[model samples]
Target: MRARLLDATLELLVERGFAGTSTTLVSERAGVSRGAQLHHFPTKNALVVAAVEHLTERRGAELSAAFEELGAEPVATAADRRTRLRAVVEMLGDHFASPVFTAALELWVAARTDEALLAAVAPLEQRVGRETHRLTVAALGADESRPGVRELVQATLDLVRGLALASTITDDSARRRRILREWADVLDRELGKELTA
Candidate 1:
């Protein structure tokens, strides 16, 4: 029941944004009573925060699996590392374009003015950001210890997220793919230079 409500909340958040997603809609979609949802979440902010956190955790685990898969592959040389870095960029682009990211984006927008929601989301957002950077650095075999390397990796995430936002409203999949590919090549050159230096 809890899981169903969370799932319904994420679906509503992605489809409706923060303004459109209501407890009534969530209850109806989840096939649960409004009373039941209130019992579980208590408030709209609570529900939205919980839902975003749920999606983030689920997506984060999938990302971890992707990083593990990268490790299991035979990356024996600098050339192989460059190839893997490109794959990681591709994977990050896919993740940013997912519904989970859309849902989280909704929360982030709403959190700007809503102090309660901001308080609820800030720590979770920090943790998510940290884990994402850590996993990306690991998967790319990038030297985070190097000056500017971590910031460059973080810049990669920001770039993909902006692309994801653009793709959400436009018929830009082909263009988005092109941009990601080009950016991957750029990351490989810049980051690889730093890591090997």
Candidate 2:
């Protein structure tokens, strides 16, 4: 029942924006009584924050699973390593382009104006930033000991976020793919053996 409410809240928050996602709407969509909704979440802020956290945790688990699955297969050659690195970039780009990201964007935008919301979301956002960097480092075999490698990974994330935003405005898939491919090639050339490790 709580899961249903959180899921419904997530959908409504993404579709309606923060101002439009009312408690009543969430309860109605969840097919639960208003009393039940209040019983679980005493306030709208609580509900929205819980929903955002739930989605973030879910996405984080997905990323961890992908990493584990890839870890099971060893890279046989430099060519294979390059391929795997590129695949990681593509996977990260796809994650940024997902509905989870869109919903998180909505929350972020709303939080910009609401101090209470900002307070609630800032820590979650920081944790996500740290987790993403750690995962990217592991996925691409990035050598943080190298001067520019960490920054390059961060740049790649920023680039993908821009691409994801563009996708929200138009069908930017083809262009996004092109940019991702071009950037991947650039990283391969610049990072050299570090990326292939």
Candidate 3:
């Protein structure tokens, strides 16, 4: 029942943004009764926030699973490291371009003017951002302690996020792929240099 409501909320958020999403609509979409919806989430803020958090958790788990599938074998050569790096970049790009990102973007836009939503979203964004950084670093086997390595990792995230944002307006898949491919090459060289140095 809770899952249904949260799923409906995420769909509505992506399709209609925060303003178009309401508790009543969510109940109807979820095929849940008004009383039941209210029982679980008393307010629109509560519902939307919970839905976003649920989606983020689910997406994070999926990404983590995908990362695990990349294998635990130690990188034996620079070419091997580059291959893993490219795979991680592609994964991050796909993640940022997913429905979860679109739904979260809607909340971020709405939260800018809505103080109550901002209060809830600000902390949530912080946690999500931190976790994403951590995951990306781990996925790439990046050592942040090296000079400029941390900033490079952060820049990779920012780049993918910008690509994702550009995709919101139209089909930017071709261009996004090109950019990611090029950026992955740059990261391979730069990170390789840093590691060897």
Candidate 4:
């Protein structure tokens, strides 16, 4: 029952921002009683937090799968690393094109001012960084202790968020592509290697 409520809340949240979605909509979407929704989440903020977590889980799975695909490839050189990174960037770009990002951003913006939400979503952000770093290290056999590795990781995540924001207004593929390429190039240079292309 709780899962259904959260999933429905997530969908509605993406479709409608925090202020636009309500308990009635959630109950209607989930085909549950208002009392049931209340039992699970006494306030809309609680539901929004749960929805954020659900979206985090979904994106985490997508990112994990992309990393798995990268690992399935044999990357032997800097050029190989660039190829994998670009593939990853493209996959991440596609995933963020969904409506979920808008809601996530809305929640993040709200979290900046709301201590409760900040408490809820902080772990999700940490998990994303840790998971991305682990996957990159595993796939490339690169020790994360290498200099600039943390910067590369941060660049990757920032670009992911930037891609979502850009896609909201312009629908420009060029921005995502260019940033991803540049970040990959920077990482490659830091690694003291050259790309084939």
Q: List, residue by residue over 87-170, the lDDT tens digit for candidate 2.
A: 887887888887788788889999999888888788998898889889988788778898888899999889988888887667
lDDT of 1 by residue, 1-197 (tens): 99999999989988999999998999999999999999998988788888877977877887788677767575778788677877888888888888888888888999999998888778888998899988887777778788888888899989988989987787677888888889888887887687557
TM-score of candidate 1 on Cα atoms, chains taken together:
0.92
TM-score top scorer: 3
TM-score of 4: 0.81
- RMSD, one per candidate, in order: 1.7, 2.0, 1.4, 3.2
lDDT of 1 at 99: 84
Off by over 4 Å in 2: 193-197
Give per-residue CA lDDT, model 4, range 1-197, as digits (tens): 88899888877767776667899999999999999899989998888888878878876787777677656666776677677666766666666666766767777777888999999888896786687667655654455576666666666667777778888777777877777777766666665442221
> Where does model 4 exceed 4 Å of error?
77-79, 192-197
lDDT of 2 at 179: 84
Q: After superposition, how far is residue 194 of candidate 2 from its true place, in Å?
A: 4.1
Taking the tens digit of each residue's C-alpha lDDT, what string does model 3 give over 78-155? 989888888889888988998889988998998899898788788878888898899888888888989888998999
**Per-residue lDDT of 44 in model 4:** 86
lDDT of each: 0.85, 0.84, 0.88, 0.74
